[model samples]
Every structure is written in structure tokens, then in C-alpha cells.
Target: MRRKILLLDTGREWGGGTNSMLELLKRIDRQKFAVTCCFYNNYSRGNSETIESILNSIGIPVIFIPQRRQPMWAKLSKELLRTLFFFNRSLKKEMIARVDEIWRVLPNAKAISSIMRAGQYNALYMNNQPSTNVEGYCAVNNLDVALIQHCRIEPQLNAALVKRVNERVDAVIAVSHGVNQSLRQSGVDAQRCFTVSNAIDIHQTLPDRAEVRERLGYAPETFIFGSIGSLITRKANHHIFQALGQFKRAHPEAKWKMVVVGSGPEQEKLAQLAGTEMIESHIVFTGFQNNPLDYLAAFDVFILASRSEGLPRVVLEAMLVKTAVIGSNVVGTAELINHNETGLIFEYGDIDRLSGYLMTLWQDATLRQRLIEAAELRVREQYAIENYVSGVEMILEKCIERRTHV
Candidate 1:
């Protein structure tokens, strides 16, 4: 008989981790594992229930765990508090505030317990940010079910909460080796952890870039550099603009333009930065794009300048598109890009080196083409969706085995 698995996302929203979960849910072998997603807050932004819609299309049923919908007043109150707290300690600090989290969590705990009692699940998979969020609260009482915490970020703080949750979770599935190492250092059992990189749907990604670019108002000759992700401070988009400024200055004759995809609080700052300098004219902020692959196709180079990462899915997407990449040399990024091989890598905070790499790639068509070809080969061979799903299945099987044995 197939083992039953339940995936949980509290206050459901499809961020990067949840996005990866959606892909996993769609591809897991139904015959070997009965997977049911239990997400609360049907009205949440990014709609965790959309996973259900996608699942139902494939004849899979998802179980929804309902909670007392917070009234607009309470939500506003919490938002007002969070805003004030953020002004004081920042989002990361507020997240690790376990004492302040108690009052907000009772409802979530009740909801998760209700779902666990409703189903006979062999394993419960908690997507990223699980340790200090709703999952951490729900995990308070349950000690029997196998738990998998899909960690996607390196929490610089929260050592105590992470340690507490790590002690209880059955496994920690780090999205990258760097994340796994970080977890181990935080006292998660090294033997009980695994690294499973974020992946792209190989089939969905096989589109013709030339046609897509032409449709997006870019000629075939336009040398476009693109970056995807929310315009958040951690994403360090300003650094990219700084690097681009220098690249344009050095290679004045190069027909290069940049496309900044996605929207966030930093959009205006980026726009203002771009406007003050003549280089801003060469920079186009495409705002928020749902289908960024189209923009990726129009690009000769893709860059990620995050202060940190958990093997960003965009990096894989770019590689799949045969787009040469330049990534910040931090944590999980090094595992994905081999400097001067698959793609270029620069020291995390070095803008001059970044600009140099950008100019060199833009100037040398042979080198750029070589990296693109190599990246495409790597994606097809090692980073396919099939491989990712299979690895996850194996992890689930082992968890089930351990659960049954215990």
C-alpha cells in the first residue's frame, strides 16, 4: 500500500518555497504516495488553494483546514503592530520573536491539530519558514508524525527556535548544501538531513527564446540582461544597477540593455536610481511579470545579486533557458554556478568585479555562447524535474520507513 503524506502551509501563500511545493505536488507518483495538502486561510494572498485547483485538474483531492477567519480589525491591528515592530527590529527580527508570536498562534495550532486528527498521514511536510511560523506552533503538541521541514533560507538569527524545532522534526530537507550545513551547525542532526535543490518543470521550460523575445518588443540583436525576483533589499538589485552602470560605461559601444523583472518596495528606489544616471535609460523595469520566462528569453545574460539564497528557482530557470548567468558568490549560489564554467561568479559585495564579468560576457560572444551551451547541458542532465521529484520520493519513502519502524 502507498504511504500517505500531508503537506502543510500555514496562512497559505505561494512564495518561493510554496512554489517549489506546488511543482512537487504535481509530479509525485500518486500510486506510491497518497498526498493531501492541508492549507488554511483560503482567502490568503497567492491563494494556497490554487495548489488544490492544479491538483484537482489531475484528479487529486486536497483537504482544506479551516480556521476562524481573522476579522479585518484584528488583521489590521496585527499589521499595524508588525509595521511598528519592523521599524524597530526588521522583518527577520520580528519573525524570531517567539514570545510575541504566542497569541497569534492558538488558532493555527487548533487548525493543524484538526487536520492531523482528520487524516491518517504518515508524514507531514512543512514548507519554508516553518520553524517559527504556523508549523512551529502546530508542531508543539504532535510528537508521532514524521515531519519534514523544507528549509529555503538561512536565518541569521533565531538560533533557539530553530534548535527547538529541529529537535522535533523528523528531517530537514535543505534546498541547497549551504542550507544543510547551516542547519547542521544550528544543531539539527546531520544524519537526518538532506539537500534537494529547487527545480524547474523541464517540459514547461522548453520554449523557443527567439520567438518569445520578438513578442516582448525586443529585436534578436538586442543584448538583454535580466533579473527576476521581488525588489526586496536582500535581493540587492541596487548592486546590479551599480554594476550595470559600470558595464555600460566600459562597453559604451555594446548594444546591451537590462530588464528588471518583478515588483516590490524597491521598485521606486531602483527607478529613481536608474533615472538620476543616463544609464537608467538603458534600464527597463518590467514591473511584476507572472510569466518571466518570456523576459528571460529576450536576455543574453541573467544575474542574481541576493545577499543570500536557497538555490533560487530563477537560476535554474535561466539555466534551462540556456541563458548565461552571473550570480553572487554566497552560500548556495556557488553550488549552482562554477565560475568561468557554467556561469560567472563574483565576490558577494564586489561591484567592480561584477561589472567586469558583465562587460566581458557582453563583449565576448564566443565565451557567452560557450557558457550558455554548458548551462543548458547541465540543466538537462542533472537538474530535470524528474530527477528532483524522484529524489523527493526517495526521501519520503525513507521517512515512511523510519516512521513505520519506530
Candidate 2:
């Protein structure tokens, strides 16, 4: 029969990775693989709740791990070490004690038991990285579910924890070649790691330009520039504002206006900085829109200024919408943009160079037209939903075939 899979995620909020997971989950063949989700409630946020609602609506059963919701020692220790960390410090305990506490408290045990009790799953799929939340259960528990880890981010803080988790999981999924390269450097087994680039929902993203422009109040002549993502330091949007400000000063009568969509902790600060510039009115912060593609459709150029990334969905979406893009030549971006062909790429955090490129794209209609045409063709051929679904299905099938052999 069908090989069953249980998905585990300890992260409480739904970010780009979760969005990718949702997209991949929707495409998995139900007849070949039964899917279930296990998550931690203690770290729960509105985004996680929203994701759960979406999954349930699609008839996916989400198993909430209550023990993970309340880690008694971690709660007590946080109060005890409040002065030491100043919000950063952790215990000076031995590795055994720390790993033990982590193992005891996380709901991985409960999750495994639930899976065993239900008596269905032959494999476990854990999304995102270095989650000790499921490691304890998978490593020691009786059920021999083939474990899979989907590594989504460029791990910064939890190297040791991620190392332990990687040691236990059967397979690892890196979202892009860049991420896979880093995972190899971090000692993740090369044989187990798979690079699966993020894909786009063309129907949701590839909107009619005229209609989207009309909805966003953009004039037919307006050269709209856009960026979508959180207003955080990693995004480096302030630099975009600064670059655009310089460009506006250079061309005082340009018809360009930028729409900064999505909100985060950096909103007020970025707003204050943007207000100090001549192009403040030119930059509109739409906060977070559920339908961001409508905004993408209105854009002549799309930009990303992130310092780090595992393959952003926005770039794929922008390319799919036929919007010419300019992004920082950071990790995953290099794989997507080809300098002058599909789009332009600049050195990460280089505002002057970025400003120059933005100016060139704004002034040169031929270059903009060329990049847009190439990008549309490339996205249609390389990043379709069918390709994404098929790749994931092949992996799931491999897991199933292995299970059958056993």
C-alpha cells in the first residue's frame, strides 16, 4: 500500500519556508503517500495558526505536541539566567544535561507515540533545520520511520543543535544549491542532501499588468519599482530607499514610484529614514498583503536587498510575473538572476552600485524590455509548479520504494 509520512516542524511562525512547504504539500500525491503534521504549540504564533487552518481546510491532520508547549526547566532557567544573557545566555550545564532536557521536554516522543498508535506512517518528514523537537523521538523511539529533514535557512545560531539533528535524520533537503553547499561545509552527509529550488504558483503570481496597475493606482506611464518581504535588517530595504532617493535626486522629474510591501520590526525606522528623503512620497509601504502578486504585477522592476537567503519565493514570483529584477548578488540570488540577461545583480550592501543600476533600468526602456522578455521565458521553462511537484514526488517515491524493500 501507500507509504505514510509524518511531517514535523518546531518553528511556530510560517515564513517563506512554510510557504514552500505548503506549496509542496498541496502537490504531493495523496494516493501514494499519506501525510500528517506534528508541531509545537509553545512556540505558536498567529502565522502558525493560520498555516494550521490552511492545512486543515485541505484535510490534513495536524498533531499538536503539548509537552513542547511547556518546557518547565527552560521556563525556570530563563528566569534564572535573565541577568547573564541580558536575553542571550543559556545554562553552563554539561552536554548530556542540555541534550537530555531538550530530549525530555520536546514533543517528539509524543509525536512518535502518536504515529505508532495510529499505525500508518512508514516515514517521517521534518521540515526546516536542526530541530531537536523530533530528534529524541526518532532516534530512541521504537518506530523505525525513515526520517527526512528539509533544511530551509542558512543556519546562523544553532550549529551544534542542527549537527545533532542532522546526525539522526535519514535524508536532508536543501532548498537551493547554495544552501546545499553550506550544509556540506557544516558536515551534513553529502549522500543525503538534495537541492530543491523554490517554485512559484504562476496562477497566483502571473497577473495581468494593466489590471494590477489599475488596482494599485499606477498611471500607465508610471515606472513602478517594487520589493516584497519583511521590513527587517536582513532585507536591507533601507538601502533600497537610499538608492532610490539618490536616483530620484539625479533624475528630478522621473515617473518612478516604489511600493515597499510587507511589514516587520523595522517598519517605523525605515519610514522615518524614507521620510527624510525627497522620494519619500515615491515609496509606499503597503504592509503585508495576502495578495502580493497584484503589487508585483504593477512593477516594472523588482528588487531584493537581503544580506542572506535560502532562495526567496519573491524573486521567483517576480520573474514569473515578467517583472525585470535587480537583487543583491547574495547566495541564492546568483542562481536566479544572470546579470544582464534575466535581471541585474549587484554586490550585497552596495548602495551606490545598486542606485546606478536602478537608474539605468529606469532610463533605458530597451534594457528593461530585454530583461523582462528573457525572464518571462526562463521562468516559464525552469520554475513551473509541475516541475516542483514532480521532483518532490520522485523523492517521496524513493522513500516508498525503500520502505517496500524493507
Candidate 3:
């Protein structure tokens, strides 16, 4: 019998993790493992097709657990508890835990447990970090089903949360070694952690670079620096603008443009920063493209200034499209880039160093070609979609086998 696995994601937005999940779901062996997706939200945004629709298109069943508002009594009680516990730290902690359990965790766990029981799912697979999937772990407690967390980012966990994970989660499939290390540091058992780097399809077709540039109103000769991902604080997109502004001021004769793809809460603030830097005219905020690969292909260079990552799929996509990449020296980005080799790297917040790397790539066509070639070959060889899916399949199978034996 095929192992019935329920993939649970609590995210309300579309991101690299969602894309990676889609890739895995599309290629997973249906005969060996039957999978159903359960999300907390539909991930709907202005006229964009919901994640439900996308999953249905690929023949995957989707279930949404709509978020319910807290009752007025619960809210008032929480406030009262807070006020009463103001002078006692331990009492405040207990009060908060009680409120959280009554208002959030218990209800969510009950709902998820019902779904698991109704579907007869053999395993619970969380598509995010432990901190975000507390309800998933809770749902599997004292149950026969195995629990696996596909930890896609470096996790931040408190003592209570760490204890909960160590006791409940059977396995954690980290997207990068950095993430695995983070889990270990956060008190997740070392034996339960596994690193399976993110991967992509090497054979996917991309739009013509020249055509894409033309469509986006850029001259063939004009140098373009591109950054793609959510316009959020963690992504540090404003740093890209800062570096660009610094570069432009030093070399006023340089002809370049910045293309930021994807939208988030930080859009207006980033735009304002660009204007303040006096490079507003040189920037294009192409908010949320469904196929950012086309833009990736058209770019002369791809840059990421994220403060942290699980494993950035965009960096891999940029590499696949032959765009020379420059990224901050963080976990996933550092793993993918080798300074002066595959691509360039800079200190996370060093605007001057970022600007210098940009100038180096800008002036040297040979270095750009070399880095692009190396990165593409590396991704194609080591990060194939087939290897990625097979690795995950093996882990899921193992989790099931262990649970059955126990």
C-alpha cells in the first residue's frame, strides 16, 4: 500500500519554499507515496491564482484550514491575565502559555488531528521550520503517524519549542547544511537532522534574454543588476539599492539599471530609499512575476542581499540562466557562492564591499563569463531535481518504516 502523507504548510504567501514544495510534489512517485497538501490559508493575492488552484491543476488534493478569529471572552481574559501577571515573570509566562494553548495551539492541533484521522494519513510532513509548524507536531503527539519536518530555513526556537521538537518530531530534512547546523544549535537532536540541499530542473526552458530585455524596455547594451524575492526586511533589498547608489555616485558615467522582482510589505519603503539615493529613475520594481526566470535570463548580473536563508532557489535559478551572481555572506548564499570562483560574496551589511564587487563584475566580461559557466555546471551536476526528490522519498520511507517497527 502506498504511504499516505499529508504535507502541511502554514504559510500565507508564495515564496521559494512554496515553489520548492511544488517541484517536489510534481515529481514525487505517486505509486509509492500518496500525498495530500493541507495549508492554513489559500495563499490568495489580488487576482492571482490561489495555491489550491495550482495544486489542483497538478492533481494534488488540497485542504485549507481557515483561520478563525479569537472570541471576545478569550481576548479579554488574555488582557486580564497579562495585567494580573505584570509583576511576576513566571506567572506571566504561565499565563501566556495558557492563553496560547486555549486560543491557538489546541484548536489548530485538534483540527489537524481530525484531518489526519479522516484521511488515514501514515505520516505528517511539515513543509516549514519547527517553530512555524508547532500545530503539526502537536497533532502527531501519541499518534501512530510519523512526523517529518522539511526545515527550509534556519530556525529560531525558544527552550519550550526546542523541547517540543526534540520530543515529537521524528525527522528533519534541512534544505542546507547551514539549516541543519542551526537546528542542532537550537537543541534539535543531531541524530534527527539531515541535510538535503535544494535542487532545480536543469532542462527547463527559459525565455530569450534579448526578447525579455526588449519587452522590459531595456537596451541590449545596457547593464542590468537584478534582485528577485519578497520585498521584505529580511531580504535586505534596500542594501541592493544602497550599493547601486554608491556605485553610481563614484562612477557617474556607468550606465546601469536595477530590476527588483517580487512584491512585499517593504515595496514602498524600498522605493522611497531609491528616491532618496537619487537613483529612482534607474530602478524598476517589477512586482511579483509568475515566471521570474525570464527576468533572470535578461539580467547581466543577479544579486541577493538577504540576511539569512534556508537555500535560496532564486540564486540557483540565476545560475542556471547564466547570470553572474553576487550575494551576502550568509548560510545558504555562502554555500552556493565561492568568492572569486563560482560567484562573488560580500559581508552581509557592507555596502562598500558590495559596491566594489559590483564594479569588479561590471568591468570584467571574462570574469563574468567564467563565474557564470562554473555556477551553471555546478548546479546542473550537484543540484538536479531528480536527486532532490529521490533523497526526500528515501527519508519519508525511512520515517514510515521506523514508525511501523516501533
Candidate 4:
């Protein structure tokens, strides 16, 4: 019999994690396992429901848990309770806060859990980051079912939470070695964890560079630098403009333009910094592209300056499109790029070094082509979707085998 798996997600929007999960849901061997996905009906933004829709279309039923549709009173009450918990040092108040959370979440968790039990799900898989979301309580409380979690971020090194997740979940899958290292550093058992890199679906046909440049109002000769990510502080978008500013000042005669894609709360701050750096004219901000991959061909070099990441899907996409990628030497980014080989990596906070690398890649066409060729080869061999899904399947099968035997 095909084992039934209950998958849960608490994300409010689409991202690398959600996109990767969508790929897995679509490709996992249905003959070996059946999947039912449950997602919170939270304030999901553009294309956030892409996964839910795809899952439904593939004969996989998606159920939205109505836990996010809280009443105004309940919302206010929780805020007040959290505020009270923050200020009160008393043990009684902490206990009260715990009681309050349990009171609010238990009934809903019970409802979700009841559905899982009725369905006879062999395992509960969590994508709604276990440490922050309350969606797992119901499933975790059911001792008969296997609980598995995919930890995709370098969570703040919380020993207790790490220990709890390790103890409860039958398996914990990390998206990269960086995340796995993080879990182990936090005292999670290495034996219980696995590392799986996110895979990307490469678009077979790309628009000609000349055509793309013309439509976007760029000259064919103009050197294009592209950075696609949320314009948030953690993304360190300001660093892109900062590094470009220095790079531009040194290469005054070079005809170049940078396209900044994606939007967030830090838009105005980034705009101000662009102006302050006097590189505003050379920068183009395309906010919140639903299909950022469509614009990848226009970039000679792609940049990822995030303060952190979990095997970013964009870097892979950029490489597949044959664009030279330069990434900040942070967790997942560092793991993706081999300095001066597949791609270039610079110290996270060092704008000057980034500028230097950017200039070197930008000036040397032969080197850029070499890096792009190398990156595309490496990504296809190592980060393809089939390998990723197979890895997931192996882990699920192992977990099921262990649970049934015990």
C-alpha cells in the first residue's frame, strides 16, 4: 500500500522554500506515496497559492486550515498577552502565556489532527518552519504518526527548540550542509538529519539577449548587472548599490546598468542609498516580478548579497541561464559558489572586495563565459530536480521503514 503523507506549510508567501516544495510535490512517486497538503489561510501575497493550485491539479488534495481567520478580538488579545509576557518576569505570567497559546491553538490543532488520523496518514511533514509555527502541535501530539520536518533556515541557535524538534520529528531534512551544520551545532543529533540542496526547473528557451535588451531600453553593448531578491535589510540590498557605486566610480568610461528586482519594506531606503551613492541613473528597480527568471538572460553577472540564505534557487537559475554569478560569502551562497571557479564569492560585508570581484568578472568576458559554463555544468550534475526528489523519497522511505519495524 502507498503510504499517505500529510504535508503542512505556514508560509505567508512564495519563496525558494515554497517553490522547491512545489517541485517535490509535483514529482514525488505517487505509486509509492500519496500526499495531502495543508496550508494556513494566512495573508499570502502574489503567487503564494501557486503550490496549492499545482498540488490540486496533480490529483493531490490541498486543504487550507482556517486557523489564520482569527477574530479581531482574539488577535488583540494575543498581542496583549505577548506584550504582558515580554515585560513580566514572573513564572506565573510565563505559564499564563503558555496556557493562552495552548488555549487558542489546541482546538484548531485538534481539528487538523483528527483529519490526519481519519485519513490514516503514515507521516506528518512540516514545512511551516517548526520553531515558529504552531501548526505541528496536533500532529506531534499524535504519537502513532511519524513527524518529519524540513529545516531550511539557520535558525537562531536555540538549544531547547532544536532538542525538542530533534526528539519529536522522526527525521529532520536540512536544505543545505550549512543548515545541517547549524542544527548539529545547536546539539541536534547528526544521525537524525539529512542535507538536500534545492533544485530548479530550467527554462529551455530563452529570449535572445539583443531582443531582451532592446525591449528593456538597454543597448546591446551595455554591461548589465542583475540582483533579484526582496528589497529587505536582511537581503543586504544596500550592499549591491554600495558595491556598484564603487565599481562605477573606478570604471567611469564603462557603459553599465544594474537591474534590481523584487520589492519589500526597504524600497525607499534602497532608493535613497542609490541616490546617495550617485548610481541611481545606472540602477533599474523592477519591483516584485512574478517571473524573475524571464529577466535572467539580460544579466551579464548576477549578484546575491543576502546576509544569509538556505540554498537559494535564484543562484541556480542564474547559472543555468549561463550568467556569471557573484554571491556573498554567507551560509548557502558560499556553499553554492566556488571562488574563481564555478562562480565568485566575496566576504559578506566587504563592499570593496565585492566591487573588485564584480569588476574582474565584468571586464573579463572569457572569464565570465568560463564561470557560466562551469556553473551550468555543476548545477545540472548536482542540483537537478530528479536527484532532489529522489533524496526526499529515500528519506521518507527510511523513516517509514524505521517506524514500521519499531
Candidate 5:
């Protein structure tokens, strides 16, 4: 019989992790494993296709948890608590998080448990970090389903949460070795942790670079530097702005522009920083594009200045598209970009060094071409979608086998 697996995702917005998960689901071995996906939200953004619609198009079953509206009294109580603890920020934040856990997460856990039981799933596959999927771990506590967590980021877990994960989760899949090391530091058993680097479909077609650049109002000769991902503090896009500002001041004769693709809470702050840096006219913010690959292909260089990552899928996509990459020396990124070979790496928050590398790539076409060539070859040889799927399949089979023995 096919090993039945229920995949759960709790994100309200679609992200790189979700994109990677969709890729995996589309190509996973269907004859060996029957998979059902359950999402906490529809991930609706304006007129974009929802996650449910996308999955339905591919013949995969999707279940959405009914959105529960909090009562007015509950909202008022939370506000009152915030007002009462206004003086102590840490206490206030902790209190709010606890209240959210009680009012939101625990109820969701009950709902998740019901879905697991009704479906008679043999394994529960969580598509995010352990901290976010606390309910997934909780839902499988007393059930027979083997629990598996796909940690896509360096998790932020407190001692209590770490204990809960170690006690309940059957296995954990880290997207990179750095992430696997993080799991070990958080007290997750080494035997139960596996590192499966994220991958992409290398053969996917992309829009012509010239056409994409024209549509975005960029001239063919424009030296475009691009970054794609949520505009969050963790992504550290402001650092990119700082680096660009410094680079521009040093090389006033160079004609260049920075294109930031994707939207998040930090958009306003980033815009203000751009204006302050006097590069506002040289920067373009394409809020959120459904087909970022076109933009990726159009870029002369791709930059990722994230504080952390779970093997950034964007870097892999950038490499696959033959775009030269400059990324922060974080776990997942370091594995992909060898200092001067596949791509350049900068220490996180080092604006001066980042500016120098950006200048180097912009000035030296030969060096940029060499990096992209090596990056593309590396991605094609090692990070294919087939290899990623097989690795996860092997892990799933082992989880099921262990469950049977237990």
C-alpha cells in the first residue's frame, strides 16, 4: 500500500519555502506515497491564484482549515493586557505570544488532529520550522502518525518548545547542513535529523531577458542589480540599499539601478532608506511578481543579504538562470557560493565589503560570467529536482519503516 502522508503548512502568505514545497509535491513519487495537503490559510493576495487553486490544477487534494474569527471580548481582553503591560516590552511581547497560543494555536491543534484522524494518515509532514508548526507537533502527540518536520530556516525555539519537539517529532528534515547543525544545538537527536538541500527545475522556460527588461522599463545597457524575497528585516534589504549608496558614491560615473522584487512589512522603511541614501531614483520596487523568474533572468547580478536562510531557493533559481549571485555568508548560501568561484560572499552587515563586491561584479564582465558559468554548472549537476525528491522519499520511507517496527 502507498504510505499515506498529510502535509501541513501554516503560513498566511506564500514564500520561497512554499514555492519549494510545491515543487516537491508536484514531483514526489506518487505511486509510492499518497499525499494530502492541509493549509491554515488560502494565501490570498489580491487577484493571485490561491494555494488551493494551484494544487487543484495539478490533481492534488487540498484542505483548508476553516478561518475562525475571534470574539470581540477576546480582542478587547488582548488590548487591555497590552495596555496593562505597556511599560515592559519583553513581558508584553511574551504575554501576547502566550495569549495567541491559547486563543489561536491550541484550537488549531485540535482541528489538525481531527483532520489527521479522519484521513487515517500514516505520517504527518510539516512544511516549515518546528516553532511555527507547534500545532502540528501537538496534533500528533497521542496519534499513531509518524511526525516529520521540514525545517526551512534556523528555528527560533525556546527550551520548552525544543523539549516538546524532541519528545513528539519522529524525524526532522533540515534544508541545509547549517540548519541540521542548528537542530542538533536545539537538542534534536542527530539520528532523527536529515539535511536535504532545496532544488529547482533547471529546464523550466523563462521569458526572454530583453523583453522582460523592456517591459520593466529598463534599457538593454542598464546595469541592473536585483534582489528577490520578502522585504523583511531578516532579509536585510536595507543593507543592500546601504551598499548600493556607498558603491554609487565611490563610482559616480557608473550607470546602475537596483531592482527589489517582493513585498513585506519593511517596504516603507526600505523606501525611506533609499531616499535618504539618494538612490531613490536608481531603485525600483516591483511589489510582488507571480513570475519572479522573468525578473531573475533580466538581472545582471542577483543579491541576497539575508541574516539567515534554510538553503535559499532563490539563490538556486538565480544560479540556474545564469545570474551571477552575491549573498550573505549565512548557512544555506555559503554551501552554494564558494567565495570567488561559484559566486561572491559577504559577511552579514558588512556594507563596505558588500559594496566592493557589487562594484567588482559590475565592473568586471569576465568575472561575472565566470561566476555564473560555475554557478549554473554546479546547480545543474547537484541541485536537480529529481535528486531532491529522491532524498525526501528515502527519508519518508525510513520514517514509515520505523513506525511499523515501533
Candidate 6:
């Protein structure tokens, strides 16, 4: 009989961890596993094309906990607090976080736990580390169900929450080794942590790159570069624009452009910066792609300039499509880029250095091909979707086994 699993996500809107859940739901063997997903509708930005809709189409019943979306003022206020946490990873953030949890998160957890307790699931999977994680942990406590935390990002929560998660969760699945390390630093036991790099459905077909570029009105022969991420401070997507501004000043006649393939809070400021730099025509922001990887083939070089990351799925997708890659030397990114072997690496905020790397990749076809081929080979060999599914399958079984023994 298939083991029934209940999956929960923190955000109403979709992000990498939600996308990862979609990927897993699409590929997991139904004969061995059955999944039902739960998300907060109150906080979610409802769209026709969404992870919830996609899951529903695939026969997974989605349960929406009607959460009132936090008002814009409250959201911004929380982000301000988080920004302070980001700039200074201090101990006091724990107190602030504990307050957030006590007032905001625990109430939501109690609400969700009521719905979850009535469900017929054998295990609970926390799809993210933010809001729903606490809910999942609280929901599954004393329920005799397996609690598996599939952490895709670093520790951004309070120490109290981490301690609670550490005590409650039976297994910790880290998307990258960097995320695994971050969890440990935040008090997760090393024995509970396992690294499972994000993978793509390699066999899935994508839109033809040439066709996509033509449809978007790009000149066929122009060299194009792109990155897919949120326009947030942590992503440092603004740096890509700054680097491109430098690239344009150095090579004004070059027939190259950039594509930013996600939307976030910093779009307005980034757009204004583009206008100021006179490179507005050199950049395109395609908001919220349903299958952004389909257009990966359109990029000659794909880069991520994030100050922080959890094994970027887009990096793997870019490699799968054979786009030459560049990443910042952060934990998740550095684990994949072997310093000019798999792909190039750059310092987090060095626009000039990033601009130089971009120029080098654009200028030399030999080097570009070398990096692309190596990246593609590495992904195919180590990070195929089938292997990832198998790894997850094993983890699920282990969690079940642990529950039985307990």
C-alpha cells in the first residue's frame, strides 16, 4: 500500500521550495506514495496558473487554509525586521523571531493543526522553513506521524523555532549541503541532516530556444544572458543590472542583452536603476514564469549573483539546457560551481568582477563551450531527476520506518 503523505508550505505565493514540491509531486511514484498538499489561501496571491492548480490538475487534492493575507503594511514591517536580521545575523533576532512566532505563527499553527489532525496522512512534510514549518511541527506533535523537513533555504527563523523543529522533526532533508550546514549551525543535529541537491525532470521537453527568442523579438544571433530569481535583497538580483551597466560602458557596440525572469519587491527600484544607467533596452524582466526553464535555451550564459541561496534549481535547469553558468561563491552555489570547472564563480557584490566574467564568457566561444559542456555533464551525472526521486523515496521510507520503530 502507498504511504500517505501530507505536505505543507509556508507561503501563499509560490517560491523555489513550493516549486520543488510541485516537481516532487509530479515525479514521485504513486504506487509507493500518495501526497496531499495544504497551503494558506489568505496569504497566497491567487493566480489561474499556480502550484495549487497544477497539483489539482495532477490529481492531488489541495486543502486551502483560508489565512488572511498579512496586510501590505504588516508585510513590509515584517520584511524590515527580517532585513535587519539579514544585515546582522545576531542573537537578538531570536527574541524578535520568538515574538513573531508567539503572536503570529503559533496561532496559524493551531488553526492548521486542527485541519491536519483530521486528515488521513501517515507523515507530514514541511515544504519550507518559513511559516508553515512551525505549523507542520506543531500539527504533527504527539500525532504518531513522521515529520520530515525538506529545508531548501538557510536558517532565517528564531532559535526557539529551530529548537522546536529540531526536537519535533524526525528527518531533515537539505536541498544543498550549504543549507544542511546552516541548519546544523542553528542547532539541527548532524545525524538528522542529509543533502539532496535539487534536480529537474531531464526528459521533459522545453520550448525551442530559437523560437522563444524570436517570439520575444530577440535578434537570432545576439548573445543573451539571463537569471531567474526574486528581485529581493538576499537574491542580489540588482547586482546583475549593475554588472550589465558596466558591461555596456566597456563594450557599447556588443550585441548582448540580459533577461531577469522573476518578480519581487525590488522591481521598481531596479527598473529605475536601469533607466539611470541608460541600459533599459539591454534588460528585460519577464514576470513570474510558469516554466522559466523552458526558455533557458535562449540564454548563452546563465548567472546567479545571490548573496545567499539553497541549491538554486534554475542553475540546474540552465545546466540541463546546456547554458554556460556563473554563480556567486556562496555555500549552495559554490557546492555546484568548481571555480571555472563546472562554471565560473564571482564575489557576492563585485559588479566589476562579475562584468569581467560575463565579458570573458561572451568573448570566447571555446571557453563558453567548455564550461557549458562541463556543467551539463556534472548535472547529468550527479543531479538527474530520477536519482533525486530515488533519494527522496528512500528518505520517505526511512521516515516511515523510524515512525514504526518509535
Q: What is the lDDT of residue 176 in candidate 3?
A: 94
Point out where model 2 deviates above 4 Å.
Answer: 41-49, 66-120, 131-142, 157-166, 202-205, 403-406
* Model 6: per-residue Cα lDDT at residue 66: 68
In every candidate, how many clashes are there? 0, 1, 0, 0, 0, 3
Give me the runs in candidate 1 sitting further than 4 Å from their true place.
Answer: 11-13, 40-52, 60-96, 130-137, 203-205
How do the residues 112-215 of candidate 2 rate in per-residue lDDT, one tens digit apiece?
Answer: 66665576677777776754344533433565566667777665435665566555556677778988898788777788788777788765535689987987
Please give each candidate's TM-score.
0.86, 0.85, 0.94, 0.88, 0.93, 0.89
lDDT of 3 by residue, 1-406 (tens): 8999999998868889999999999999999999999998888644588899989999999998888888787788878888988998777866777777778878898999999999999999999888778889888886899999999988877788889888878899999999999899888899999999999999988778888889988997789999988889999998888999999998899889999888899999998999999999899988888878999999999999999998899999999999999999998989999888889999999999999998999999999999999999999999889988999999999999899899
Instruction: Name the runs in model 6 displaced over 4 angstroms.
Output: 42-47, 69-92, 130-132
Error of 3 at 377 (Å): 0.8
Clashing pairs in 4: none
Each prediction's Cα lDDT score? 0.76, 0.75, 0.90, 0.80, 0.89, 0.80
TM-score of 5: 0.93
lDDT of 5 by residue, 1-406 (tens): 8988999999878998898888988988888899999998888543578888889887789988876888676688789889999998877877777777887888988999999899899999999898889889878888987889999998887777888887878789999999999889988888889988899987788578888889888888889999998889999999999999999899988888899998999999999999999999999998888888888999999999999998999999888888999999998999899989999999999999999999999999999999999999999999988888899999998888889789
lDDT comparing candidate 5 with the true structure = 0.89
- In model 3, which runs have C-alpha deviations exceeding 4 angstroms? 45-47, 70-98
Off by over 4 Å in 5: 45-47, 69-97
Q: How high is the lDDT of residue 37 in model 1?
A: 72
On residues 24-113, what C-alpha lDDT tens digit does candidate 1 reach at each position?
877789889997776664422222345666767766666675655556665566667676677666553555344335545766666666
In model 4, where do residues sit more than 4 Å from their true spots? 42-50, 69-100, 103-108, 202-207
lDDT string, candidate 4, 160-208, tens digits? 5666676677788888899889877878888888998788765356567
Report the lDDT tens digits of candidate 6 across residue range 1-406.
8888888776745677766777788888999888888777523332456666687789998887765645566556666777767767564465456666665677777876676677767788888763346767776666888888887876676566677776878788998888888888877778888888888777777678778788878897789989887778888877888888888999998998788888889999999999988899988888767668666888989989988888888888888888889899897888888888889999899888999998999899999888888988888888888877788889998898789799
Overlapping backbone residue pairs in candidate 3 total 0
